[model samples]
Target: MITDVEWATFVPSALLLAATPGANQLLTLRNGLRHGLAPAVSASLGRFSAFALMVIAVAAGLGAVLAASEVAFNVIKWCGVAYLLWLGARTVLAAVRGQVAGEMQKTADEGDGKGVRGGLSSWRLGWQEFLVAATNPKALILFAVFLPQFLPRGAKDVAVPLLVLGAAYIRIEFCCACGYAALGSRLQSMGISLRARRWLDALTGVAMLGLAGWLATENH
Candidate 1:
């Protein structure tokens, strides 16, 4: 029952929000550098799994009710917007600090060490990814939109079918996030200078802030 446009609307925003290179992405990058590709991939996978599970659980319990209420939707949307803005601010601050710290590491690695660390720490990355996804109210709202569109009205058993769709969506999303993470790791490996990494962080922060501003100004 989900229309193509609705499905279209769901994927880009959800993936962008999830894949945004901020704390979680940075952590994934760090993990990759510290551990390896396998751990990095696992972290991304775990994080997405968390999102999928949350969407399903929330949908089974409150998806229909929230979908029916415009007021509740507004509340959740504003909360998500605020959170994004906060995250953006933090990213900017982190970038500034990273610039200074990275310089020291650069000197150390160039002089004393053979090379910068390689690979990701799987457990750490996975836990960090899960936390980021779990705490995101916007993620919850995104699912609120997704599940109802796919569900048949007055379905006798909402739970079973909802879970199935949730699993499917999660699989799609997990693959997407992993793809993005892999790309990011490769980019990081391409001798991303400290200056460049800081600049990328700045850009990501700006994008998030702009998105938050747009969300705040939005009527719906």
Candidate 2:
């Protein structure tokens, strides 16, 4: 069982990490702007689910294999980098063609009656977020290092403690995602012009591309 002091220390650290504007947060913001709050929250849940799985893998000792194997690490890293680049390119192209802004307005004018057809389906968004979080080698490594530190001293079973801590971390991430998505939704409701929407798309695209570059350059 985690002590009170450990819980106090861990909760703040986890929330601080979750609140950082990383790929997950960026994707949530983009989804909120394009599809609305529900889909964004779905995506966030998917991401947290992925993180939970990673924690399980670490507790099961598979994380060591991934960390030590260059082939496994590079494969996952490149996949994440490729996906980020593809998403960025797609967003930039949509912005340039003015499809993003036009479609958003059309959906609004049409009362969003078409639901998933009006934009990305929530299921697809969730799956995409899952893939992004699952394939992130950096996250795997971070979990491998970070989860163990919070383990209770001389614990008989490591897995349970790791799992408990992981759940706490996921909770923090979910709350942060909610706040960020809500902020994004509020901005979307401000009647941003088409030009501004286009600009937002372009900026999101740039950020995605930058993250891809950072991931690509990261050493193991």
Candidate 3:
């Protein structure tokens, strides 16, 4: 069991890490602008779900295997890079066509009576976010190292401690995601012109591509 003192020490660090801007937060921001708050929240949930799975894998000692195997690491890394690149291309294409793009188009059409089309659905967005979060080597490494530090000295049962800390970390991350989503939604509601929205989309596409490039080139 994590003592109160340990939790006190962990919570601040967790909150700081969660609040730092990263791919997940950026994705949530994009979702909020393109889809709405609901979809953004869903995406956050998907990210947390993936993080939970990673935590479980670490607890089960898979993290060691993954860290040690270059082939496995490269496979997951390439998959993530590919997905990000694909998503970036689609976003850029949608911007060029002046369409919402993805599943959000349907929702936007229904809500606003506008026929803006293209892009992925909320569920698909969530799933993609899940994939992004799951295949991240940094996250895997963090779990493998970070979680154990909080474990009580001489703790025999490791899984429970990991789950508890993981839950807390997820909660913090979810809150940060909500905050970013809400901020994005507010920006969306500011009545920007179609041209400006298109520009935003372009920027998002560039950001995604940049992330993909970083992932591909980063040293493991």
Candidate 4:
């Protein structure tokens, strides 16, 4: 188990990493834009639930095996890379097609759900976030490597402390997702010019593309 002093450092560290931009946050932003904040925030539970499973995997010693086995690690890494590339391309294409802005603006102005809903249900949103977090090898690395540093030395049961830290981290991560979703919701509420909305979406899409590159090149 972690002591109070360890908890102090762990909380801030978890918050810092939680706030770091990544695929989950990107999905939250997209969901908020397409749906609404409430559904987006609720759907984010799917991502953190995947994180919880990863912590369990780390506790069961599977994480070490993945880290040691290059093939397995590469499998997960490539999956994440592929998924991100697809998401980025889709988003960028939507923005670039130049057909959404006007329709979306009108929808926003009229308080209609047509442009916002996009026929995306909460369960679907949840499932997508789950896949994004589950497929990310770096997230497993965080639990397997970074989290252990905060554990009490010589503890007979390692799983408990890891679970505690994972729970805390999940809370913080959820909060971070909420903030991102909030921003997207705010943008939608503004009913700004079509150009502004289009630009914002384009920037997010480009950022996702850049993140994909970074993830592919990042040291495992």
Best-performing candidate as measured by lDDT: 2
Report the C-alpha lDDT of model 2 over 128-186, residue by residue, as the tens digit: 78988987899988888877876767776787778788888888889999888777666
- Checking candidate 2 for backbone clashes, the offending pairs are none
Model 1, residue 36: C-alpha shift (Å): 6.7
Off by over 4 Å in 2: 110-115, 118-120, 154-156
C-alpha positional error of residue 115 in candidate 2 after TM-score superposition, expressed in Å: 5.3
Sort by TM-score, best first: what order? 2, 4, 3, 1
In model 4, which regions exceed 4 Å deviation?
2-5, 99-103, 106-120
Q: Model 3 segments beyond 4 Å from truth?
A: 101-120
lDDT tens per residue, model 4, 82-122: 88888778777888887557546655655523334444666
Clashing pairs in 4: none
Which model is ahead, 1 or 3, in terms of TM-score?
3
Candidate 4 — worst ten consecutive residues by lDDT sum?
Answer: 110-119
Residue lDDT tens for model 3, 3-58: 62288778888888889877778788777777677667866788988998988898
* Residue range with the least summed lDDT across 10 consecutive positions in model 2: 110-119
TM-score of each: 0.63, 0.92, 0.86, 0.89
RMSD of each: 6.1, 2.2, 3.4, 2.4
In every candidate, how many clashes are there? Answer: 7, 0, 8, 0
lDDT of each: 0.59, 0.81, 0.77, 0.79
lDDT of 1 at 174: 62
Model 2 lDDT, residue 119, Cα? 45
